[model samples]
Target: MKISRIVLASVLMVPGVVLAGENARDHFRDEARAATGELASELMQALQAAMQEGGPPEAIAVCRDRAPAIKTRLSLERGWRVSRVGTRVRNPLLGMPDAWERRGLAEFQARHADGEAYADMEKVEQVVEDGQRFNRYLRPIPLQGQCLACHGDRDQMSADIRGILDDRYPHDQAHGYQAGELRGAFTIKAPVD
Candidate 1:
């Protein structure tokens, strides 16, 4: 009778456990989106200011130097691992998404190719690694008019900007992009209890 009761209790708790997991996933997704938006806004503003003050070269500096600093600070403050990664990378330091991020980016690309709005492209998953569960979220980053000054057509780019990019990133693969194209993605990971 005791064994039967324990079995019944476990069966009854399954639904609640599943529901809790779903709720946790949703909560983490929302949190990731909010944090990503804030970080993107701050970075964009800083890049805009840098561009206005100098030019695309200065903006590159903002991306190369300031962006990592912002990611680090935000990660510490928000208790999440935050980063930007791309299929083609400009900075080697942050180049190449992990396996999970690669899958998310592929999905985003497929959705975009299927005519889905770039703004609507996102992926959130609960993954287990080393017996610990994590909530991983990714949102597409579409190229903008400002980004074209650096990441656009090679021939159209100013000589100074090209030179700077080549010098700073010897193996840069992040170019030849157009506005409205998927530039990369913001990826966030947070541990889940």
Candidate 2:
């Protein structure tokens, strides 16, 4: 009788365990999305202000300096690793994507190619590295009209802006992007508790 009772309880708990896991994933997804949105909004607003105050060339300093500082602050505050990465990166400091991020970027590109709206594109997963569990999330960063001032076709860039980019990032590969194209992604990873 006791054995049968134990078996019944185990069976009953199975569904609960599965549901809990799903709930946890959902919670992490929500947290990641909120954090990503906040960071992106902050960065975009700063960049826009810089462009208005100065111009596209001056905005390059924001990307080169301010963006990383924001990432660092957010990572420290939220206890998550946060960053922006691109397929073709301008800054060598933030260019290389890790294995997981590489996979996420490829998936984003594939989904975009399949006609998925960039704004609606996101990737979330549970990743285990060295026996540690992490919730990884990435959202596409679509190019906007303002971004074109700097990231547009070479011919479209003024010589001054082009020279600034060339001098700052001689090996830059982030160019020739059009509005509505996938510029890159904002990636975040939080440890699973």
Can you give the TM-score per candidate against the true fold? 0.89, 0.92
lDDT of 1 by residue, 1-193 (tens): 9999999999999999999878877888888998899889999999999999988888888998899998999899988899899867887678678889888888888888898998987898878998998888899999998898889998999999998988878888999998988889998988877
> Measured by TM-score, how close is model 2 to the native structure?
0.92
Residue pairs that clash (backbone atoms under 3 angstroms), model 2: none
Question: How would you encode candidate 2's per-residue C-alpha lDDT over 1-193 as one tens digit per residue?
Answer: 9999999999999999999999998988898888889889999999989999988877988888888998899899999998889877888678567888888888888888998888888899998999999999999898999898788998899999999988888888899998888888899988987
Lowest lDDT sum, 10 consecutive residues, model 1, at: 87-96
Error of 2 at 178 (Å): 1.5
Error of 1 at 27 (Å): 1.2
**Candidate maximizing TM-score:** 2
lDDT of 2 at 133: 92
The CA lDDT of each predicted structure is 0.88, 0.88
